[model samples]
Target: MLNVLSVLIGLFALLFMIPAFLPFLGIANWLLVPVALFGALIGMLSTRNSGRNFCLLVAAFGALRLFLGGGIF
Candidate 1:
C-alpha cells in the first residue's frame, strides 16, 4: 500500500512538471518539489529497493525541473 502510494506520488510529481513550462503558470509549479520529496521519503521507508530507486529518480527529476525552471537555486 505504501509502496503503491509512493509510486503514485512519484508519477504525479513527474507529471506536475508539465505546468512549469507554461508562461501563464508561475511559482505554483514549484509546489511539485515538496510532493516529490514526500514520495522520496515514503520510498525510503519501503523495504523494496525498486521503490526507493524509483522515488529517488522522481525526486531528482523534480529537483532538476525546479532548478531549471528558476524555482530553486
Candidate 2:
C-alpha cells in the first residue's frame, strides 16, 4: 500500500516536472523536490524497493536540473 502510494506521488511530481525543464521554469523544481522526497520516504516503508527507487530517481533528476540551472532558473 505504502509503496503504491509512493509511486503515485512520484508520478504526480513527474507530471509537474515537465514544465520545470524549461529554460526559465526550473524554479518549479524547488517545489517538486520535496514532493519527490516525501514520496521516497513513504516508499522506504514498503518491503519492495521499486517504488523507493523510482521516487529517488525522480528526486535525483530534479536535483540535477536544479544544479544545471544554478539553483534558480
Clashing pairs in 1: none
Q: What is the lDDT for 61 in model 2?
A: 95
Please give, for residues 1-73, the per-residue lDDT of candidate 2 as tens digits. 9999999999999999988999999999999999999999999999988888998999999999999999998
Q: CA lDDT of 32 in candidate 1?
A: 74
lDDT by residue (tens digit), candidate 1, 1-73? 6778788887887677667656545365468767877887887787765655676786676566556767743
Model 2 clashing residue pairs (backbone): none
lDDT (CA) per prediction = 0.70, 0.94
TM-scores vs. true structure, each candidate: 0.71, 0.96
User: What value does the lDDT take at residue 27 in candidate 1?
Assistant: 61
Which one wins on TM-score? 2
> Could you tell me how far off, in angstroms, the CA of residue 51 lies in candidate 2 after the best superposition?
0.8
